[model samples]
Target: MLRDEIITVFGGSGFVGRHVVRALAKAGYRVRVATRRPHLAQDLRVMGVVGQVQLVQANLRVPASVERALEGATGVVNLVGVLNESGRQTFSRLHALGAKTIAESAAAMGIRRMVQVSAIGASATSLSRYARSKAEGEASVLAALPEATILRPSIVFGTEDSFFNRFAAMARFVPALPLFGGGKSRFQPVFAGDVGKAVLAAFERDDARGQTYELGGPGVYTYEALMRLILEAIDRKRLLLPLPWAIGKVIATVSELVGALPLMPVIITRDQLIQLQSDNVVADDAKTLADLGIHGETVEAIVPSYLERYRHHGQFHEREA
Candidate 1:
């Protein structure tokens, strides 16, 4: 049976967005993917049957475009966020302002069901601009639609994710990996698939409305431990060097400068370094994945499958006893 509800998902072409779109499609909701480039999001069409998924060009900075995206939509999902800022894509504009625009527009359209995906460390007083902007976005979404479900997930990991893939790529060439702040900061890496389920549950469950949930995995691991896990997954041994915060800051500054040059890859940003100063874990008192009836996947189960490509001989090589 086809459902009459339509869900306009902002940033539906992104990593996490793909998971959410897939879940929504499996659950029989028609998905309208609103993105800046409809041409680039053609892959999302395969997530649903022909005509079941539609793509429309929409820019959050333009209220008119945002308003148009919500036309005939019964629900909205704001998955748009930036890990790094570029020209015209600052944190304030994308995270806070864009979120507000979506919420307010949904409210005007009388669409009460909404979900906002935020980071776990989001706070008004956070030292990192990314976290602070996320907090602002959460506030704006709630203010405009008080019943909108806010999901704060820790570092999300998947096959195409930047976190594990980045280090695994680095291990391929670099002899050592730097552990910012002595690698003591902890993280509860949550799977991207589980987060998608959480979004679906939030929309279906009445208890989730107007509530904030912190999504994390079952186990917590330190920065160093995570790095070591990446190395082990790829069957490689590399030095895990402990770098002081001051030194990491200097390196990050230089990286930012070098990244400014055309064709240069950004290894790390100063703001990202600041984020590493704090633990990216769920709080003891926060509502968890279990509350939503999701059994989060472990890094050991999923990380190794994707990281296999980074191994010597690409998974054909046998481990020595």
Candidate 2:
């Protein structure tokens, strides 16, 4: 297998990181899963042959830890990101400075293939601090590793994703789902597996180096439509309430405060509200999965399979008499 060469994956224990790690392992690449808690990543071992995957504790906030993770690695991928600021893990610190630290270390090691996972709305001038920090991360990465491949994906959906799972759970409890912005916010949700495959494809081509790709699913869905799908899949009915920006901001502010408690409400944050105001689809001009010769999945075709568990009678109940 070609993967005998070491490929270090930063944040490999995370949601997207797990998928990427499996994909890389399947491609026959030796993988090093780097995260703050290496013990939690023991599950990653089953993805590859015994000893093919190693988990190392690496914190990007500390340059020494990040540099140590990069040692003797031919390739590196950065998948570290956060939705909200928790204590010292601020947006600037984690997204911007953390990315710089990792990329700089990779470049210093002369690693040629570096993949960075970012979001579609990452812009230095964006309204949300999350988006702005993402843009800063991109810039810092490019500054250090000019040939790094950056992938900015739309809302990623999978069985374990927060997007659909949150709404599905909300349908179970709340009679009405409060949308951040009038339920008109648009998104093209890409499958996480597709994004992982794209990362590997990008790693194979030097042409992909120094370039950015935007990945999206085949269908573009409004927030209201998305909620309706979740309800239908979960076999629960609910009202889709459009939250005006002003009301949403206030609610988000309160939610942020409440989430500070020992047990968080899992509520959306102010930055997330700001993000919903903007479109999250891939730009027409950008290279997408299709450009990479990959056909993308639609939410309609894929989501129901996993969501069946939430149905009234479960999978067996769906059997026709």
Candidate 3:
């Protein structure tokens, strides 16, 4: 494969997208980051040489914008997704339709390579709208171009991630943390960088074409166990309350309502509660990080480096080693 090929990445400024872009740049690929806000993606220019990286304003909802972004790109990656529905970013619009638009444009424009980043629990029949829309996106992409690659990753974590960061932030101020469904739901917390590497690997390997890869870390932990891991990382001792499913739903709904206010953090949404009903881990006998030739980063090694910032001393704490 030519390293100098142009690759257009939708949502390239996102948590995982940023890492993917960095990895692609390091691998010698010129990257075009297509996002709704080119201003926000300005920092990506530094990822590559003076002009190796370009940011183009493209909204997937607008087919014309999607097509323009694909111009002069041999490879494309769709990382656009939403955890919750906001003003105009609905799951159906962003995940399903957006992916379809990109896939169709790539196919029509004769773009040979593409990849879609989706979650593990995505299903056409899923109760969670998030999961269902992701499934829809995968299906729509394949319908347009059967050779397009698809990746389904478990809960992705990093210093900038909403998963561990959200809880760590809450632990800093809240007296207690709530665990939905008794925290029994399992998750394989893959590192964000690992996910990026996997994306690049998929693009490099011909065998990965038209195949779905389920990406997960080396270890799996329950919801409660992961919470405890966060607590240990932050060196904070707080009650881990196991809230009932019904009660958790109520709280999540209230939180979304509060999000409607001027300046409220987007806490868990009702769709998230619905997603928690299923374990977010790679399925048995399925190809995973190992198949991608990736030894994913562990929670123990990576989580601490970032979570240390949330510690009492805030990066000044003495290291045991």
lDDT of each: 0.94, 0.88, 0.91
Model 1 per-residue lDDT tens digits across residues 199-277? 9999999999999999999889999999999999999989999999999999999988998899987789999999999
Ranking by TM-score: 1, 3, 2
Q: For model 2, how does the per-residue alpha-carbon lDDT over 67-164 read when each residue is reduced to its tens digit? A: 88888899999999988789898999988999999988888888877999999999999989999999999999999988898999999988888888
lDDT of 3 by residue, 132-205 (tens): 99999999999988988899999999879989989999999999999899999999989999989988998899
Q: What CA root-mean-square deviation does each model show from the true structure?
A: 0.9, 1.7, 1.7
Q: What would the TM-scores of all predictions be?
A: 0.98, 0.96, 0.97
Candidate 3 global CA lDDT score: 0.91
> After best superposition, candidate 2 residue 98: deviation in angstroms?
0.5
Of 1 and 3, the candidate ahead on lDDT is 1
How many backbone clashes can be found in candidate 3? 0
Off by over 4 Å in 3: 318-321
Shift in Å, residue 72, candidate 1 = 0.9
Which lDDT value does model 3 have at 116? 92
